[model samples]
Target: MTTPIQIGLLVFPNMTQLDLTGPLQVFAAVPQFVPDPGAEIHLIWKDLTPVSTDAVMVITPTVTFADCPQLDVICIPGGYGTDALIEDQEVLDFVRRQAEGARYVTSVCTGALVLGAAGLLKGYRAATHWTAMDMLGAFGAIPTHERVVVDRNRVTGGGVTAGIDFALTLVGEMFDHPTAESVQLRLEYDPHPPFNAGSPATAPADVLARYEELIAPNKVRRREAVARAATNLAG
Candidate 1:
């Protein structure tokens, strides 16, 4: 019998729910698309407790870091809480250990920052939320502006809703295109955004300026945090 495909998603306080949930929904649907060996997905945190997200939703971790089983894939989702996680030694240690054995080490949005903090993206091309793309260089990563990027075993997705596309890509890699297409059909993954302002290049000049200004303070904090994390990794 084929070993079950084990996937673990890191959960933390103040994470963007969509970052975790979007990819999660696609991975969870794997069994419906392809049977037999199946897939097992788990929410991993410091403890098996409920964690609040950036939005109104709260998620409970299915396993604690200490108790998490060996996983085939480790996915870290991004959010405001990533600032704290970048400097979190315990969390970084857990991620580092898991990535050592996992077939794929992945992230969505700012979650790539967490992977960078753990020193997993060095010399690899990765993707993250547009606002934080340049910051990847601080961790020795080549930042790419794309919806999803795969460099070796490190697969990263761009901001927010890109998680779904990232997960579907992962499914296609693990199974086949037909299987992923079927899952996408099941979820009715169609996009037709009324606005064409998803990125800095596409957004109106005024809108882009406003977003940059709003995130400036957080960006400063992230830079400092990433520098410190890089130091820790080097040490």
Candidate 2:
């Protein structure tokens, strides 16, 4: 029998729910698409305790870092939690160890910052939330402003919604284009946002400026955090 593919997604406090769920929804459909070597997905954390996302709901981890099997794909989902995760040496170490053996090392949104902190993105092209794109250089990464980026085995998605796209891309890579297409079709993945302001480039200048102002303080804090993480990784 073919060994089952293991996929682990890190879950932690203050994570954006969609960042984790979008890709998860896609991965969960793998069995229907690929029968042999089925996928086993795990929501991993430092411990088994339930953690709250930035949204209203809470998610309980299925596996602790200590007990997580070697994963074929290890994904880090992004959100405000990453601000703390970048400074967390324990989490960084776990990620580093997993990346050493994982077939695919991936991230969604600011989760890329966590991988960067773990010294995994250096010299690799990566994608992250647009607000955090500039910070990638601190970790020696070339930041790409795309919805999804695949460089070697490092797959990164732009922001929360992009997680779906990222996972579909991975599905294509792991199985086949037809499988991914089927998964997308099953999910009814067609998107037509009511507004075109999903991106700064597309948003009106005034709205974009105000949003930038709103996030300015948070950006300052994140910049400092990234700087500290990058320095620690360097030392």
Candidate 3:
């Protein structure tokens, strides 16, 4: 019998729920679209305790880091919590160990910062939330400002909602266009926003300005976190 592909997603505190769930939904459907040896998804964390998200949602991890099998794909999703993760040695070490065996080391949004902290993104082209794009340079990564970026084995997504697009892209790469299409169609992943304000480039200047202002404090904290993480990586 063909062994099922192992996929692990890090479900940490304060993560954006969609960052993990969007990809989780996509990968969970792999068996329906593919042959017998399909993917098995695992929600991984330090323990089995329920993890709180940035929002009201709480997620329980199916596997702990020590118990997680070798993964074909290992993903980290991002949120306000990422700032703390960058300097978190235990979390960084766990990710580093997983990436060594994983065929794909991936992230969504500012989770790229966590990967960067693990010294995995050095010299790779990556994508992250626009606010943290410049910070990629600290980790020796080339920041690509697309919705999704694939550089060798490291795949990353831009922002919160880009997780869906990132997962679809991974499905395409892992299987084929038809498989990805099948998954997309199954999920009814059509997006139609009432306004074109999803991105800073497209948003009204005043809206973008207001967002920047709102996130100014976060930006400061993120920069400090990145600096500490970079220093840790350097040493």
Best by lDDT: 2
Question: Which residues of candidate 1, in runs, are more than 4 Å off?
Answer: none
Task: Kindly list the per-residue Cα lDDT of model 3 for residues 90-173, writing each as its tens digit.
Answer: 899999999999999999999999999999999999999999999999999999999999999999999989999999999899
Candidate 2 lDDT tens digits, 1-235:
6988999999999999999999999999999878788899999999999999999989999999999999999999999999999999899999999999999999999999999999999999999999999999999999999999999999999999999999999999988999999999999999999999999999999999999999999999999999999999899
Q: Name the regions of candidate 2 deviating beyond 4 angstroms.
A: none
Give residue 193's error in model 2 in angstroms. 1.0
Q: Which ten residues in a row have the lowest lDDT in candidate 1?
A: 31-40
TM-score of each: 0.98, 0.99, 0.98
lDDT, model 1, position 27:
95
Give per-residue CA lDDT, model 1, range 1-235, as digits (tens): 6778999999999999999999999999998877768899999999987999999999999999999999999999999899899999999999999999999999999999999999999999999999889899888899999999999999999999999999999999888999999999999999999999988889999999998999889889888888888888788
Model 1 scores a TM of 0.98
Error of 3 at 185 (Å): 0.3
lDDT of 2 at 37: 89
- Poorest 10 consecutive residues by lDDT, candidate 2: 30-39
Better of 1 and 2 by TM-score: 2
Rank list by TM-score? 2, 3, 1
